[model samples]
Target chain A: MQKSTQAGFWKKNQRALAPWFFMAPGIIMFLVYVIYPIFQSIGISFYEWDGLGPKTYVGLQNYRDLLDDDSFYTSLKNNVIWLVLYLLAIPAGLAVALFLNQTVAGIRLYKSLFFFPFVISQVVVGLIFTWFYAPGFGILPHVINFFTGTPTAILADDKYATYGVIAAGLWPQTAYCMILYLTGLNNISPDQVEAARMDNAKGWSMLWHIIIPQLRPATFIALVVTVIGALRSFDLISVMTVGGPFGSTRVLSYFMYEQSLSEYGTAMGYGAAIAVVLFAIMLVFISLFIVRMLSQERNA
Target chain B: MFPKPIAQSGPWTQRAYKTLLPIALVLWLLPLIGIAITSIRPGSDLASGNYFGMPSGFAGWENYSSVFKNSNIGYYILNSFRVTIPTVIGAVGLSCLTGYALAVYKFKGNLAVFFMFVAGNFVPFQILAIPVRDLTLHMGLYNTMTGLVLFHIAFQTGFCTLFMRNFMKALPFALIESARVEGVSEFRIFWHIILPLVRPAMAALAVLIFTFIWNDYFWATVMAQSVDVRPVTAGMNELKGQYKVAWELISAAAIVAALPPVAMFFLMQKHFIAGLTLGATKG
Candidate 1:
C-alpha cells in the first residue's frame, strides 16, 4: 500500500520537482553570489559609509560628490574614451582575419602565433606592453624617435598614457576578434560567395556585400565582447599605469577600485555609486544581449 | 572565398604574399618576442644595451631558477591551481544539472531561469565587488583560497549554465521521450542516457573555465589579501615590486605565469575554440 502511494505521488509531481532538483544548487549559488549583490550594491550607493564604519544614510550625496570630484570626471571621460576607441578592435581583427583566411603554407602556425596574446594572462600582456612602451629600453620609442626628434616618455605623459594602455588592450582583443572572424569565415556559405562572384563582386565589393552580411553573428558577438572588455578594463590599467600621471588613465572600474579597495581610503558609498554608474552603462549592452538571446530562444 | 585564394592570383602576387606572412607575424608578435628573448638574456646584456640584439649569454636557466628561488611564485601558482580546479569542477558539474533541467524539463518559468543566468553572466564585476567581499567575510571565507574558489564557481556557473543549456538543447529530445516511455526513472534517464551524450560539452566547458579562473586577476586581488592565497596573476604584481629593476627575472616569472594557460590552449585547442565560439555562430 505504501509502495503504491509513493509511486502515485512520484508520477504526479516528478516533472515539477525534477527541474528544481537539478536547477536548485546552480540557481541558489547564482542568486547568492551574483543577483542579490547587484541590488545590494545599488542600495549601498545612496549612503555614506566607509567599509568599516557605521552605515549612515546620505541620500544622493555620493552621486553629488561624484559631480564635483575632478578625479571622478577624469575617470568618466577616460571611460568614454575607452568605449569609443576600443571598437577599433573589431575592424582590426576582421582585417587580420581576412588577410590570413587564405590557404597558405604554415598558416595554422601563423594563426596560432597571432592568437597567442589572447591565450596568456592579461597581467603578462600588460607587463609585456609596459616594457614595450618604456622610454629608454622600450622598442616603440625607437619608432617614435625615428618619426620625431625625441623619444617621448609615453606612459608618463598625460597626452598619450590612455592611448598606450588602449593599444596594449587591443593586442589581445584584436586576437580574440580575429579568432571569431576566422571561425565565422570558415562557415560562410560558399554558394553565396560564388553567386556574388558571378555578379562581379570582387575585392571590397565582395567583402562588403557577400562576406560581411553573412558575418553579422560574428560581428555582433565581437562588438558585445569589445564593449564589455573596454568597460571592465581594470587589470590593464592596474598593471600598466595604476591610474598614474595625474590620474589620466583611470576608467570607472579602476577608479572605483582606487576609491574603495585601495590603501588610500575606503569611501564605500562613493565607490558604490561609481559601481552603479558602471553597472548602468553595462546594463544597456546586457539588455541588448538578452533581447538577442531571448529572440534566439524563441526561434529555437 | 571573398578575397579569392592567392593560388588563383598571379605568381608574383602569390610570392609576395608568402614573403609578407612571416614578416607580418614577426612584427605582430614583436613585443612578446622581445620579452621571450629577455626572459633568457643575461642581466649583463640589458645593462650593455643589448635590448634588441642577441643575448650575450643564455641565462635562461639562471633567471628561471632565481625566480622560483627568490620569490613565492611557486606558492602563488599552487594557489591558482587550488582555485581553478575546484571552480571548474563545481561550475561545470552544477551547470550540467542545470543545463539538463532546462533542456529536458517542460516546466513553467524555464526560460526565465535560463535567461537570468545569461544576463548575470555578462554583468561587470565592479558591481558585485563590495557585496561579494562582504558576503565572503560574513561567511568567514574571506582571504582564503576557498573564498576565491567558491565565488569563482558561483559566478562561473552563470556562464557555464548558459553554455551547457544551449549545448544540451541541441541534443535530440526524442531520446529522452523514448526513455520516459520505457518507464526509466528521470534521474537514471539523465545519468545513463544524457550524461554520456554531453561529455563533449562538459570537456569544452572545463577547459574554457580552467583558462578563465586561472587567468583571473581582478577577483584575486579583491578577495586575496596575502601572498599565501594570492593567485599568480596578482602575485606577479608583488614580484614586480620585489624585482624592481631585474627585467630578466621579471620576464622569466611573467613567462612562467603564462605557461599553464598557453599550454592548455594548445592542448585543448578544439574544445577551447568550441567553448569560446559558443554563441558566435547563432544568436
Candidate 2:
C-alpha cells in the first residue's frame, strides 16, 4: 500500500520535482563556486578586508580610492585599448577564412595547422612572442632591422607594451574567429549564394549583404568571445611583462590580481572593487548576450 | 561557392591562389614554427647567437631530458592529470543531469536557470577568485589537487551545462515521451534511454574539457602554490624566473606543456570543432 502511495505521488509530481532533483548537483556547484561568489565579491567591494581577519565596512571607499588612483585610470585606459584592438581579429579572421575557403589538396591539414596556435596554452604563446620580440636574435627585431637599422625591445617600451601584448593575444583569437567563420562558411546555403550571384551581387556587396547576413550566428559568438577575451587578458601580460616597465601594461584584471593575490599586497576589498568595475563593464555585454540567447530559446 | 571559386576563375588566378596559399600559412604560423625550431636547437647554438640560423645539431632529446631531470615538471604533469581527468568527468557528468533537467522537463524558471549558467560561465575570474580560494581553504582542500579539481568541476559546469543542455534539447523529444508512457521512472529513463544517445556529445565535451583543464594557467597559479601540486603552466612560470635565458630548454618545456592539448585537439579534431562550433551555424 505504501509503495503504491509513493508511486501515485511520484506520478503526480515527478514532472515538477524531478527537474529540481536533477538540477541539485549542478545548481549547487554553480551557486557555491560561480553565482554566489559574484555577489560575495560585490559585497566585499564595499568593505575593507585583507582576505583575512575581521572585515570592516568601508562604504565605497575602495571605489573612491580607485577614482584618485592614476594606476587605476592607466589600467582602465589600457583595457579600452585592448578592447578596441582585439576586435581586429574578427575581420582578420574573416579575411583568412575567406582566402582559405577552398578545397585544394591537403587543405584539411592546412586548416588545422592554421588553427594550431589556439590549441596551445597562452603561456606558450606569450613565451613565443617574448622570444620573437626579444631584442637580440629575435625574428621580429630582424624584420624591424630592415627598416630601422636597430632592434627594439617592444615589451620594454611603454608605448608599445600593451600593443605588443594585444598582438600576442590576437594570434590565438584570430585563429578562434577563423574557426568560427570557417564553420559558418560551411553552413552557408549554396542556393542563396547562387541566387545572389545570379542577381549580380558579387564580391564586397555579396559579402556585406548576402553572406554576412547569413553568418550572423557565427559573428555573434565571435564578438562575444573576443570581448570577453580582451577583458580577461592576464596570462599574456603576466608571462611577457608582469605589468612591468613602469606598470604600463596593467589592466583592471591584472591590477586586481596584484592587489589581492600577489605578494605585493593583500587588499582583498580593493581587488573586489576593481573586479566590480570589470564586472560592470562585462555585464553590459552579458545582458545583450543573454537577451539574444533568450530570444533564440523562445524561437526554438 | 561564395568567393567565385578559384577553379572557375582564369588559370592564372588559380595558379596565383595555389601559390599564395602555402605562403600565407607560413606567415600566419611563423611564431609557432619559430618556437618549434627553437625547441630542437642546441644550447651551444643559442649561446653562440645562432638563434634563427639552421641548428648545428638537433638537441631535442638533450633539452627535453634536461628539463625533466632538472625540474619537478614530471610531478607537475602528473598533478595536471590528477586535476584534469576528474574535472572532465565531474563537470561533464553533472552537466548531463542539469542539461537533461533543463532540456527534457517543463518547469517554471527553466530559462532563468539556464541563462544563469550561461552568464556565470562568462563572468570575470577575479570576482570568484577570493571567495573560491577561501571556500577551498575552509574545506581543507587548499593547495591540493582535489581542491583545484572541485573548483574546476563547479566552474566548468557552467559552460558544460550550456553545451549539454543545447545538445540534449536537439534530441528528439518523442523518445522520452514514449518511454514515459510505459511509466519507467525518471532516473531510469535518463540512464537507459537518453544517456546512450548523448554519448557522442559527452565524448566531445570530454575532450574539450580535458584540453581546457590541462591548458589552464590562471587558476593553477591562484590555487596551487607548491611544486608538489603546481600544474605544468604555473611550474613553467617558476622555471621562467629561475632560468632567465635557457630559451631552448624553456621552449622545450613549453612544447611539453602544450603537448597534451595539442595532441587531444588533433586526435579529436572533428569533435573539438563540433563542440566549439555547435551553436555557431544555427543562427
Candidate 3:
C-alpha cells in the first residue's frame, strides 16, 4: 500500500519536475557565463595582475588608482556627453516616423530605405561616416568649404571628434528609434484620434496631447536602448577614431577595453574596476526598469 | 490615419507629396548611396580625387574579387554563420521551455526567475567580459568559435526568455488547464499545445536573433582572437587596417560583410518588426 502511494506521488509530481528539467540547460549556461562571471569580475577588480600571471589581491588599490586617473575623467565626461546627445535620436526618430507614417505610393520602400542604416553593421556605418567626414576631399569638408570658406577637419579636431562619432552613431540609432516609433504608430487606435479630432484637437496640440501619449511605450523603449547603446559606445569609437585626437572620444566601454586588452594595456585589475563601475551605473537603470516591469506583471 | 493619409487630401497636395517622397529618401540615404557607388568605382577615380563625380570605370568585379582573394572574408562570413545559427537555435530553444514553465506552471519562483532574465538582459556586456573570458579560458574554450557561441547563447537567453515569457503569458491558459484536468501530462500539453501556439514568436525571434548575432561586433572582437574563429565584423576591421588605401576593395568587403543581415531583414521584415514591437504597442 505504501509502495503504491509512493508511485502515485511520483506520478503527480512529475509534471512539476518537468519545468525544472526544462530550465536546467538554460539556467546552467546563464549561471556559468553571466551570473557567476559578474561576481568573478567584481572579485577580480580587487586584485592586481596582468591577464597572464598569478593574480595578487591588493584590495582597493586599483580603485584608488582610478581616483587619480585622468583618462577615467575624460572617459566619464565623454560618456556623459554621449548619453546627453544620443537622446536626440528619440525626438529625431519621432519626427521622421511621423513624416513617414503617411500612406502613399511606394511608402513601404521609402521606410525600408530609411531603415537601411540600422540593418547594416556598425563597422560599415563607422567606415561610411569616416569617409563622409574625411578631410579636404570628403563631402562634408567640401560642403563646409562651400558654405564657410574655411573647412576644418572635423575628426582631427579634438573638440569635434567625439561629436562627429556621436553623429555617426545617431545616424543608425535614429533610424532604429524611427522603426520603433513607426511600429508604435501602426498600433494607435483610430477611434482615439477620431474622437480627439471631433473635440477640435489638431496640429501640435493633437500631437502633444493625443499622439505622444500613445507613443509612450515606444519612447520608453527608445530611451532605454539609446541609453544602453550610448553607454556601450565602443565599435564606432574604435573603428573611427580608436579614441583618438588624444583619446578625446574614449567612453567607459572603450576605456575599459583599452586598459585590459590593448597592446599598451596590461592592467586587467584596473580595467575590471572600470567595468564594475559601469555595471553599477547600469544596475540602477536596470533595477528601475525591472521594478516597472514587475509592477506591470502584477497588474496584468 | 492620425496624420491623415495624403490620399484623402486635395490633388495638388497629393502631387506635392509624391514628388517630395523620392527627394527625402535620396537625402536620407545619401551616405549609403555614396558608399554603394564608391564600392563599384575604380581605384583610379578615388586616387584622382574624383569622389563626387562618376567613376572612371566600373571595377565592381575586380574590387569584389580582390576582397575575396586578399582577405579571409569568406572564412569570416562562415564564422559569423557558425556563431549566429547555433546561438539562435540554443537561445530560442531554451527560452521556449523556460517561457512555457513561467507561463503555464504556478511555480513559486516564476516571477522572480522571469524578472532575473529581464534584468540580466539589460546589463552592460563589459561587466561580464573579464570573468567570461576567464571562465572561457579555464574551460579551454577561449579564442574558439565554441567560446563565442557559448557566451552568446547564455547572454541571449536573457532576451529570449523575456520575449518568450511575454508571448506565452498572452496565450490562453484554458488549453493547458483543460489538458491538465483531462489527465493529459503537463510536458505533453506544453510540447503539443503551448509550443505550437508560440511558433509565431519563435519565428520572429529566430529572424531577429539571426540579424543580431550576425552583426555583433563587440563580442566577436573580445572573444575570438584568431582569423579562423573571428566573425565578419572584427575580420572586416582587421581587413580595413591591412588594405588602408584600397578603398574600393574595402568597400566591397564591407558590403559583402553587411549582405547577410540586410538580406535577412528584407526577407523577414514582418516577423522582425512584430518581434521588436511586441511590448511597445501593448504598453
Candidate 4:
C-alpha cells in the first residue's frame, strides 16, 4: 500500500518535479562555483581583505583608489585596445576560409594544418612568440632588422608590447574564426549561388551581397567569441609579458591578478574591484548576446 | 560555388591558386614551425647563432628526455590528467541531466535558467577567482587536485549544458512523448532512450572538455599551487624560468606541454570542430 502511494505521488507530480530533479546536480554545482562567486566577488570588492583574517568593510574605498590609480587607467586603456584590435581576426579568418574553400588534392590536410595554432595552449603560444621576438635570434626581429636596420624587440618596447601580445593572440583566434566561416560556407545553399551567378553576380559585389548575408550566424558567433576572447586576454599576457616593460601590457584581467595574487602584493579587495570593472564590461556584451538568444528561444 | 570554382577558372588562375595555398599555409604556421624545428635542434646550433638554420644534429631525444628528467613536467602531466579526466566525466555527466531537463521540459523560468548558464560561461575568470579560491580554501581543498577538479567540473557544466541543451533540443520530441504515454518513468527514459541517442554529443563534449582542461593555465596557477597538484601549463612557466635563453629545451618543453591537446584535436578533429562551431551555422 505504501509503495503504491509513493508511485501514485510520483506519477502525479512527475512533470513538475522531474525537471528540478534532473537539474539538481548541475544547478547546485553552477550555483556554488560560478553564479555565487560572481556576486561574492562583487561583495569582496567593497571590503578590505587580504584573503585571510577578518574582513573590514571599506565601502567604496577600493573603487575610489582605482579611480586615482594610474595602473587602472592604463589597464583599462589596453583593454580597449585589445577589444578593438582583436576584431581583426574575424575578417582575417573569413579571408583565409574563403581562400581555402576550394577542393583540390590534399586540401583537407591543408585546412587542418591552417587550423593548427588554435589547438595549442596560450602558454606555448606565448613561449613560441617570445622566441620569435627574442631580440637577436628570433625570426621576426631579423626580418624587422632587414627592413628598419634595427632588430627591435617588440615585447620590450612600451609602444609595441600590447600589440605584440595581441598579434600572438590573433594567430589562434583567426584560425578559430576560419573554421567557423569554413563550416558556414559549407552549409551555404548551392542553389542560391547558382541563381546569383546566372544574374551575372561575381567577385566583390557577389560576395558582399550574397555570401556575407548567408554568413550572418557565423559572423555573429565569431564576433561574440572574439569579443569575449579579448576580455579574457589574461593567459597570453600572464605568459608573455606579465604586464612588464613599465606595465604597458597590463589588461584589467592581468592587473587584477597582479594586485591580488602575485608576489608583489595581495590586496584582495583591490583585485576584486578590478575584476568587477572587467565583469561590468563583459556584462554589456553578455546582455546583448542573451537578449538575442532569448528572442531565438521564443521563436524556437 | 561562390567566388567561381578553380576548375571553371582559367589555367593561370588555377596554377596561381595552387602555388599560393602552400605558401600561405607555411607563412601562417611559421611560428609553430620555428618552435618545432627549435625543439629538435642541438644546443650547439642555438649557441652558435644558427637559430633558423638546419640543425647541427637531431637532439630531440636528448632534449625531450632531459626535460622529463630535469623537471617536474612528467608529474605535472599526470596531475593534469587526474584533474581533467574527472572534469570531463563529471561535467559531461551532470550536463547530460541539466541539458535534458532544459531541453525536454517546458516550464516557467526555463529560458531564464538556460540564459544564466550561457552568461556564466562567458564571464572572465578573474571575476570568480577570489571567491572560488576562498571557497576551496574553506573546504580545505585548496592547492589540492580535488579542489581544481571540483571547480572545473562545476564551471564546465555551463558550457556543456548550453551545448547539450541545444543538441537535445534538435532531437525529435515525439520519442519522449511516446515513451511517456506508455508510462515509462522519466529516469528510465533518460537512461534507456536519451542517453543512448546522445552518445555522439557525449563523445564531442568529452574530447572538447579534455582539450580545454588540459590547456587551462590560469586556473592551474590560481587553485593548485603545490608541486603535486600543478598541471603542465603552470609547470611550463617554471620550466621557462629555469631554462631562460636555453631555447632548444624551452621549445621541447612547450611542445610537450601542448602535445595532449594537439593530439586530441588531430584525433577528434570532426567532433572538436562540431563542439566549437555549435551555434555558428544556426541560432
Best by lDDT: 4
TM-score of 4: 0.99
Best by TM-score: 4
True-contact fraction in model 4 equals 0.82
**In model 1, which runs have C-alpha deviations exceeding 4 angstroms?**
none
Model 2: how far residue A229 lies from native, Å: 0.9
Please rank every candidate by DockQ, starting with the best.
Answer: 4, 2, 1, 3
Residue-level lDDT of model 2, residues B55-75, one tens digit each, is: 999899999999999988899
Candidate 4 per-residue C-alpha lDDT over B158-249 given as tens digits, one digit per residue, 9 for 90 to 100: 99999999999998999999999999999999999999999989999999999889989999999887899999999999899999999999
Of 1 and 4, the candidate ahead on DockQ is: 4
lDDT of 1 by residue, A122-236 (tens): 9999999989998878899988999997998889999999999999999999999999999999889999999888888888888887899889999999998899899999999
Residues A98-200 of candidate 2: C-alpha lDDT, one tens digit per residue: 9889987888999999999999989889999998999886799878888898777899999899999999999999999999999999999999999998899
Error of 4 at B54 (Å): 1.0
Best model per DockQ: 4
Interface RMSD, candidates in the order listed = 1.0, 0.9, 1.2, 0.8
Worst 10 residues of 1 chain A by lDDT: A259-268
lDDT of 1 by residue, B1-283 (tens): 7578999999999999999999999999999999999999999988888888889889999999999999999999999999999999999999999999998898889999999998898888989999999999999999998999889999999989988888998999999999989988889999999999999999999999999998999999999988789999999988998998789999999999999999999998889888888777766
For every candidate structure, what is the RMSD over all alpha carbons to the true structure, in angstroms?
Answer: 1.1, 1.1, 1.5, 0.9
For A17-77, candidate 3 gives per-residue lDDT tens digits of 8788878888888888888888888998999989889999999999899989998999999
Greater-lDDT candidate between 2 and 4 = 4
Indicate the residue-level lDDT of B145 in model 3.
88
What docking grade does candidate 4 earn? high
Q: Chain A: TM-score in each candidate?
A: 0.97, 0.97, 0.96, 0.98
Query: Cα deviation in Å at residue B230, candidate 2?
Result: 0.6
